[model samples]
Target: MSDNMFEFAFNPGEEVVIKIKAPDLKNKMGGETLQHLMGAKREMLLALRSLLDDAIARTDAADSPAEKTHIDIE
Candidate 1:
């Protein structure tokens, strides 16, 4: 496999976060094709990928939904 081992994750809704990490495109693939992406860390885009993943996993269906929250403003 090439150093182009790139992947991403994205969650779309009220909040938007985009994270990107891949081998320097021009160095290997000359260009890249994007897949799913995740949360954004303006300083280090790469690290954001895991941050979102972990967060989502915590809320995964397999886990108990025993503790959910709802808020309304009036």
Candidate 2:
């Protein structure tokens, strides 16, 4: 609906540096929208973390010569 979109970047070095674009609530959603969006984002991230952990456990438990090198979820 709006042109506004979230952006994230991760840079790897001795330590990983992560960057994220903060939402422009005033310009994009008028007022008080960021709070609602953030709540949803938090829940989504928690769910994603749980899913990834389960997948990793399953992969680790499987005894197979073929190993998973990459996974793409969209």
Please estimate how well model 1 matches the true structure, expressed as its whole-model Cα lDDT: 0.48
TM-score of each: 0.26, 0.44
Candidate 2 per-residue lDDT over residues 1-74, each given as its tens digit: 23434344456655433333445556656345767887776886787689779989899888556766897899
Which portions of model 2 show Cα errors greater than 4 Å? 1-26, 64-74
lDDT of model 1 at position 23: 47
Tens-digit lDDT string for candidate 1 (1-74): 33333344457665553333444434433223322221212335445657768888877856765777899989
Question: lDDT of each prediction vs. the true structure?
Answer: 0.48, 0.63
User: What is the C-alpha RMSD, rounded to one decimal, of candidate 2?
Assistant: 12.8
Root-mean-square deviation per candidate: 12.2, 12.8
Task: State how far residue 57 of model 2 sits from its true place (Å).
Answer: 0.6
